[model samples]
Target: MYYADAAADNSVTAYDLSSGSRTVLCNMHVQELTLYQEKLYFTCTDGEKRTIYRMNLDGSDLESLASCEDLWYMTIYKDVIYYVNYENDQYAILSMKLDGTESRILRKYNASDLCIAEDKIFFAERDTRYLYSMNLDGSDVQQLNSTYSRCINYMNGQLYYYGSEENGRNVYSCDLNGNVTGKYTSGAKFLMLMEEELYYYDWDDVLHILPLNKKSEEENTSHGTNIVSYKQEDVLKPVRSYLASNWAGYTLDEGNITKQGNTWIILLSESGGSRQYQLIIDLTTGKITILCTTEDILPVSVYLYDTAPSVSPSAAQLSEEELNSIADTWYEQNYGPGGAWCFEYHDYDGNGTYEAFAVCGPVMGDGYDIDPYNILEAILYISSTGEITVIEKDVRDTDFCVENEIEKEYYIEYDGKGYYVPHFRSGGILWQPMYGVKDNKPYDTGISGHISLDNDGDLLYTPNSGIFMCPECNNHVEHKHILAYDETSGELKSAVKYPSGEIVN
Candidate 1:
């Protein structure tokens, strides 16, 4: 037997009739509660979120079973607790084990007033305004009766319910097979059967006791005193802790931290090497698994540094066709005709010789350049089986003119080997230069240059400040403020803001 009390002092308590003792189930702001197997289950609404808790009959072992931003009604059956989750924008029936494991949605919509019968479940749905029943496994579904009800219970060979439709609220009893026997006079909102007495709460906020068979006035009053009393303000605190310890790590590079089930899995790259280590921590058992040292593992060097490598987004997995397409496009953009002549030191040929290819074509431009042409460069790889590689080359102009001088030239120079060059042309004139070995290697030292372009197609030499352009309008605008472009039919817009509190468009 169970009852809820919210005294004038705002304390809430739930009483167990067998022990004739009351326990403070939830100390917080609880709006609803139910009892099963001597454990008190209740819903507490804290701010915008609601959490369901379960505790021992003595209010000792309290634990939060499930939580969500919006949870309405709850009922317990077997080893699972089912509740109505309202935040999903649909009526969803969710269930979780008594141990707070495997919480998942049971069904969606067509759900109201849920009750667990002997091996069967009953509920009222809005669409049909009928009472329905189904096996505990959610199969063999069938409608029991047509009515608008909120609370339902199945005891012995009878079904008891209370609901409101056009005529306020009333209590009704029916057989297990959906045959309504009669309606009781009491206007009860919830009903329960205990010791052959119909225990229910009336609309007057007072508890009522009705016998299965008509009883005398004295018997009715005597049965009412047997119902345990409790104060609603008595809050119950659970026995278990909720928060987890903070995670500590040396670096975040190549690190993967994820939660699986009740365990946290962490895969981290070892310091100063490509090797990685794995750690698994179980929250329930308080166990940790660490792979520190293992056989058949090679020892790598490590170094301490003030700064660590910044991790970029992991590369997406691509199929063979996708990889081939991407490689072909990249090759064309970097080595095709009118493209940049940059050489990538990959094993393009099966030959053991790590040869160099002077690619001449139009490649994709990286820096600020509108329709930028391709440049040239040399390539070298560490070995056929090695991962590291190098690129080297130099760029030189055909003419010795001052303006033609390659100033601000960007060349892909190796940290160890050669350098590459950039190729630019105009008209039918050809400006190809001959290569020769000098100083034990190929080198260039005439009119080599670099160039930087602004966001606009205009060229800029030694610009004092970094310029940022609006991505949408392509306008060289300030940072943060919106700018409208008169060109492009007023379709162009940019954001520009000065270091001061001024905005310009």
Candidate 2:
């Protein structure tokens, strides 16, 4: 079996279950080490990027899969790697091919404890008392039960998890239909799921295991997918020290800083998504300083099929001036002024055509200052054929874009289909899955507080944590209080948190 050994140099270790011999597969600070189809997929830092890498079990032909802003839990379902990609001010569950093609964001909210159960991916919901399930394409999400699972897995038609209650810790088992089957060991912390054994830890942190029935191809199973507070804890030291400077009286902690050759690039945020900025730091001088703003900043996937067609111009043909001119116009027209922007040319949609994706938004303010409503974050797409399409979003009507409900969507069917948008309507919350999601399921109140897709016709919604303003009052508000969800009811609970940890609704 393959697992991770992060005690020292951080390696992927393989252990012979029978012979009990150990072998080191790779030496990189790895997270979410997954073995699929004889290839091991894992994530590590390359100084400038948090990249996912793929290699053989025998440790040869190591290749890069994709580079994301951040990734926590990862699992392989049907040869595709579904991972939690952390963004500047938010987190999303994204899926891509094993080699990093066909990338899509499934959810804007947080995901936790990802695994597969009964042909669907199962995971534990953080800060909640339920286990959830979803399809591989990021649809059909539903709450399994009220069990406050700490870690979980599925095996032999049984959903197994280690959960904690007011009394103590307990291991529980249930069927695919959410019926309690039996109760396993108690007062134990579930570590992971094996083919026929359950690994656990006691109160003293001693590891132990108990045997169970075997499941076919158990290596494909993911256990205990968890998402932490999401700081760039693994960033290089120089980058961290630079960020520690607190540029512009703003805090740069919890942001991404990577070293690319002599240049240091940073994607930073103050409070997750409230104040996000991209900076290119130059280390050529004796002291580090700001070099430029606009280069590639948005995290994107690079696939084998991303090669351009014959009609596409050569790398030398597209001058930097020409590209920046196009990007500058788009940013000023669609987004706003006084912001940082970065663009990258790639087949981000995996449609075999290269597109220049321009990510631009305003600079964030320090905690004391409130932001203006003029700041609208926009991701514009300019295809090689000169076709421009903006990623559709259901955001507030910051500008004239919200003149009509239809226009409020702010998207065209041509391209950049942003799926699973949680629209908080006057009646209730409804999720708009425009395309690329499973259509078989229904949505309703029964599946409330969950991100699953169903056909119940209920208003499915998720918290919209964006630059929000009180439309009637026309005042800027704290981003944290802008979008807070009641973890139990799944309703748009009106609440806000101040910097002093005070709660107001």
lDDT of each: 0.47, 0.51
Writing each residue's lDDT as its tens digit, candidate 2 over 73-188 gives 77787777877766664557788887798888876676677776557877666657477788766788888788777666777788777766442466778787667665544456
Report how far residue 407 has shifted in candidate 2, in Å: 74
Q: lDDT for model 2, on a 0 to 1 scale?
A: 0.51
- Model 2, TM vs. native: 0.40
Output the number of the TM-score-best candidate: 2
**lDDT (C-alpha) at residue 439 in model 2:** 19
- Using all chains and alpha carbons, the TM-scores for the candidates as numbered come to 0.38, 0.40
Total clashing pairs in model 1:
48
Off by over 4 Å in 1: 1-4, 8-26, 201-203, 213-505
